[model samples]
Target chain A: MSGRSRSRQSSSVRISDEQITDLVHKLQQLLPEIRNRHSDKVSAAKVLQETCNYIRSLHREVDDLSERLSELLATSDTAQAAIIRSLLTQ
Target chain B: MANSKSAITLLNSTSSRLCFARTSATFASAPPDQLKRQSRRIKMAAYSSMARVAGRRRAWARALLFRLHTRPRHKTLMRRKRRPSTSSDDMVGKLRRLLPGGETMDVCTLLEETANYIHCLSTQVKVMKAISNHHLSKVN
Candidate 1:
């Protein structure tokens, strides 16, 4: 009587053993799956934007570099390679 | 008697349809010019508000969804097929449109064309250089 009453009196809010177990167990089951799905979608959008920026930059560099190469090759070679180079230059 | 029967059938089956048709007919009976002006204002407001609220991400997402589902590789195939044809034609169109006043844009055309050509040539050289380097490495 003394131990039980003292413990109960010390804590105004009492959590039953079954209630504590159920709450912790349910939270343990749910949290990781929720974090993963949310993280995955955010990760996908970020990656997509990064890829677009990179591809666009690559395009500009390719166009600029190819134009220069075409000009360089125009006088030197008339092969398909050279023609492409010259064509791009034009 | 037949007319009354048909009217009764219509009334029982489609009071809502009749209402919609009646309402539309009333609007259609309005002055055409007034309806046109009101419709135009509504459309303009709708487009402007949509323009303000729409984010770039939504357009990208829509394009991604479209590419994933409908015409997935069709645009890519069309784009690939288009590349060569459009280059020359694009140059012509760009020049032709720019010089709409009958003045010659030949100089500009020749310049951009030459630039475009050089870029093409250089890219080819790089590709060839890359291939040859790979071959040389293999040989070694």
Candidate 2:
């Protein structure tokens, strides 16, 4: 189990733009179902639940973006530091 | 005139000292509960003011983001208008000439833009959390 876990950790998965597009398309399709689910008989509790779910999803997106942003910032910072060090040394 | 001015200064200083003493005495004699309530009120006021400032900053950031988003579109429009007769190849040359520092500047600009976008996103997240908290507090 440890070896299998190590192998999985070693492999990095890259998500393609096409995959994102497909996921977006699937989400768009799912929207109507969500709308239909609460269309006719919308209760306050249901609306609140839906809103909470929506907010949670947004929070997740923000968290993901923040993580990516931090990674990019770190990479750029390191590169910039290396460049500055090299220039100073020279 | 000097005598009148000196008298005026003396009167002003005495009045100010009297007012300060009155205020301090009142504050010192106030009940503990009243003091606590006053402090709470002050704290609440400060918090609300901070929230208002944050909201204003978020609005400013959103406006900046809107400008950033539209800037490229505006640039393209201007490019089309300015060089209707120019070929695509010429456009590249023109852009290179227009942007003085070339690739390094472009990379720096891209990094700055990304940083601004991240700042905007983080501000939005903070605003969202505040809104959710406000809603929850209201419900409770």
Comparing only chain B with the true structure, the TM-scores of all models are 0.26, 0.27
Candidate 1, B17: how far from true, in Å?
A: 63
Stretches of candidate 2 off by over 4 Å are A1-38, A77-90, B1-140
Give the CA lDDT, 0 to 100, for residue A2 in model 2: 23
Whose TM-score is greatest here? 2
lDDT of 2: 0.34
TM-score of chain A of each: 0.35, 0.40
Top-scoring candidate (DockQ): 2
Q: Score the docking of each candidate (DockQ).
A: 0.01, 0.02
Instruction: Tell me the deviation in Å of residue B130 in model 1.
Output: 2.9
Worst 10 residues of 2 chain B by lDDT: B99-108
lDDT of 2 at B32: 53
lDDT tens digits by residue: candidate 1, B38-134? 3333222222222222222232222323333455432321022322445543433332322111123233222332223222223333443342333
For residues B7-64, write the lDDT of model 2, one tens digit per residue: 3333233223322322333333355544433333322222232223333333223333
CAPRI-style class, candidate 2: incorrect
Q: Report the TM-score for the A-chain of model 2.
A: 0.40
